[model samples]
Target: MTGRSQTEDLARLFAPYESLAATLLGRWDGSIAEGDGSHDRSHLMRVWQLVRRIARGEPAADMEVLVVATLFHDCVAVEKNSPQRAMASRLSADVARRLLDGIGWQPARIEAVAHAIEAHSFSAGIAPRSTEAAILRDADRLDALGALGIARVFYIAGRLGTQLYDPDDPMAERRPLDDRRFALDHFETKLFLLSAGLVTPTGQEIGRQRTALMRAFVEDFGEEIAMPEDLALAD
Candidate 1:
């Protein structure tokens, strides 16, 4: 899609919170010089959609905090394979703190938003300490579990020059699983495990549904590729 069209679409998505969207979008453009398909504005919008859905089940969550946190959760773009990947959430949280401070937000509220942004990351390993943080964390991760998750896996693998799977052992029946070398391995290494770790009940429920789809995709892939009968049986 054209850049203008994407911007217009995002504008419509965030129209309910114009002021916060304006500030967040401006900061986002300034932060990421080169955006990837997987973590661009579209990703933010999807996560926001999920956050809103999850928040409906969580009455105690602060909508404003979730909005701002969702917008800035990945303000700093870090490659998935980067050594600094784990610090991406912390860096994004710092940017969120500065932007909220500039807008004269209360320290406590800013901290709340910052905490949600900081803990939303999978690699960060920071537990969500509040309702908002937990909701944001669950929402962000939910985006990485389903159809979008499937698309993103291959997209990133192509970018990283990884294989679709091992030609001789697509399901890794005889070889060790390595996501860095094969895209399909990631389903086992991370995606399938996400649903069980989800913090919110809503997120967990959605994750289970999505992950089941992912598992079905993997099974179909194995069958289509005609995995050896013995190996398939072992799997």
Candidate 2:
């Protein structure tokens, strides 16, 4: 198939899945998915929006791969602490492949999507290859910024029973998550690192600005913790 034809074919394949994206995210449905709310379907949608927005501005972007990769990046949940974390990541890719195949997507398209999904996980440690992969990865990180990012942090924290912040216990461990460790540690580890790790130029710029926003929020949080009564000082 010609390049444009291939792109159009992929778009056709993805149209049905695009419609079902909202239905798959049961947690973000009513009142934040009835869970701690970490990354829900709405989170997936936001990443999709960011990916498309960034992709549209790039002349060389392969929008199909970005769409597929973003959709399946978190098809399965990562365990906070499990020897099976890798297994979970792999399962997500497998699920993506199956769905893509079921939709009559080309084998090559499915492979590209699966590869991107496999590497999108923070713990996966796999480098992205195509432009689509890079954009999707950066888009996912963008979800960790702004007010939505803040809500997700606390939501996941509440799920794990972790406090919002505690300067006494520094973040040292390198695992998924558990109830004990404070959620703020996430900022120190993944969130802070994400901005610098973006692969695309658009992603890098947006990540930098968003990271600054998140950092400022963290700093304000620290200030509030130091003196909750003097709220006006933060302003």
Candidate that would win on lDDT? 1
After superposition, the stretches of candidate 2 with alpha carbons farther than 4 Å from their true spots are: 1-36, 167-180, 227-235
Could you give candidate 2's per-residue lDDT for residues 1-235 as a string of tens digits? 1244333432344454544433322212122211325665466557777887778767787666666577667656665666676665567778777766766889988888887777776777788887777777778778877677777788767766787765443333345443347787778766778877887778888888888888898778776666444654764
lDDT of 1 by residue, 1-235 (tens): 2354454565567657766766655544454323688888678778889998998899989888988888778878888999999999999899888888888999999999999999888899999999999999998888888899999999999898999998877888899999999999999999998888898889989998999999999999888888577986998
| lDDT of residue 225 for candidate 2 | 63
Off by over 4 Å in 1: 1-12, 24-34, 227-235
Scanning candidate 1 in windows of ten residues, the lowest lDDT window is: 25-34
Cα deviation in Å at residue 129, candidate 2?
0.8
Question: Model 2 — which ten-residue stretch has the worst lDDT?
Answer: 25-34
